[model samples]
Target: MTSHADQPNVARTLTGQSGGEIPRDDWSAGRGRLFLLLVAPSVLLLVLLNAYPVFYAALQSVRNGTLISPGEFVGLSNFAKVLQSPDFWHSVRFTAIFTVSGVAGSWLIGMALALLLRAGVYGGGTVKVLLLLPWVVPIVVSSMAWNWLVATPDSPMPTLARMLGFETPLFLADPLLAAITVCVFKVWCSFPFMMLIMSAALSGIDRSVYEAASIDGATGWQRLRYITLPLTARTTYISWILMTIFCVNDFPTIYLLTAGGPIDATTSLIVLAYRLVFQNFQTGPGVAIALMMTAAMVVVSLILFRQIRKSGGPA
Candidate 1:
């Protein structure tokens, strides 16, 4: 019963409500298909590149096998042997020390640097650039530089100490000092990343919060302690988790500088695994150690992720 004029009006109404000639429902179907197409390749690639290798390694770790030797279904025997080894124990101890010290140092230094940069102080840009330089440089190059600086007998640090009328402290000679040196260098190399992340997080804060705090006579330290720090908790937590993983797995700095020596004093879990796998050709224990380290990192990451989610957040 509708006339041509009424038909045109009905068509215009439908188009107006839909926001275009195409219906919103139709647009959604097309967008969904496009998204699926875009994501499919990445999903497949991840499965092939990451998931497969992980499951394969897990399978290999359970069985007595090698790239060169025949396989046997040993089933946790390797894990048992690794748990009892003295070298493994030493590596674990070193790893704990390294993870704790390195991560803590990185967190503190990063926070300090971020705060300094945020303060609009003089030379802030220059300092940030210089700090970032270490992180950008290749790990091998940084480790080499550290090695030269800490070399025995007439090294730069020692010479500087002597010039300042202080006795030369052997950096890599004493085991304790050597470990400390590694931790310090790692902190220097790592803090920049933390600084960068924390700075970004700081930028996202509501400026009004700070203004209000100031109007209420909140001191600088009080503002930072209560407002800024709490707001930055997520970023700080993430930095801690990442730094811990990296510290635990880091081999280049420890290997190049101290080689975990001075009687295995600086040796870490990753370094010990590298030595076993490559140096001694003990593939079994080496693989086992690597797997254990990986498992630890995974567990820690999962815990952190859960905590983040539970706090009404996502990372």
Candidate 2:
């Protein structure tokens, strides 16, 4: 019904090539520009706040500096000194123990709680809120409460030990006991986060899959092993990576609980770095330690990221 000239114009309009509407290519370009405009401020802020400090720290790591002034350039000597220090190695060992215990213990407890909650236990909402209180409470307040419960021979834990006919256990005085206490405290404070993560991942799974497994005569443990775990593998790896970083970078947890004390038995790398920078005024070595920690974290993250990819990518 249309004439030849009119048909061409109509076709152009349909394809968004007419003067009244933007062409597809132009529209795409415009959208991209708008996205960049919206994201530019956040990008700039990240570069300023995170990137700049990391760059500055990298430079400082190569120089023998202090809080007062940037001292002589020392190349990698600071790193070498840190690596050779017995105290540094001691802290590294303790950090390894702390991180492993925190991650594994919290994950196990959280998974169990998540499964229990998923079963629609009575008063689940209230129970979940109660479980979350440890994480929700201010760390400072929690630390103080823990300190009061274990800091002295007259403390509640020690009193309980006495009543049980055992010697007064020095929870924060003995090096080994202090280390154990800190690691356990880290687990207590962190498990709620893992619970929330695992809960969400479990919720995403299809209920029909479990029903089918049960119909096929699969046991509860078998279904969990084969179906629940595999389906949540991506989320599990992500949580591990996040918790690893959190454990590595955690400063206040150990500091407030033990102050790296009795003999620095609970000192993590972050605590060691703090001592080096502020207490010892060895800025270069401190920053070098931090950089080494960052490198190690990157390696761990990449390994877990590969696991996530194997588990069908991110959740």
Predicted structure with the largest lDDT when compared to the true one: 2
Q: Number of the top candidate by TM-score?
A: 2
Which lDDT tens digits does candidate 1 get at residues 127-230?
78888998999989998888788776588988898999998888999888988898888887888888899999898888899999999999999999999888
lDDT of 2 by residue, 1-315 (tens): 898878755655425445465555676788899999999999999889998999989989999989889898989999999999999999899999999999999999999999999999999999999999999999999999999999999999999999999999999999999999999999999999999999999999999999999999999999999999999999899999999999999999999999898788998999999999999999999999999999999999999999998888952
Q: Which ten residues in a row have the lowest lDDT in candidate 2?
A: 10-19
Question: What is the Cα-based lDDT of residue 73 in candidate 1?
Answer: 79
lDDT of candidates 1 onward, in order: 0.84, 0.93
Residue 140, model 1: lDDT of 90
In the order shown, the candidates' Cα RMSDs to the true structure are 4.1, 2.6
lDDT of 2 at 45: 97
Residue pairs clashing in model 2 are: none
Clashing pairs in 1: none
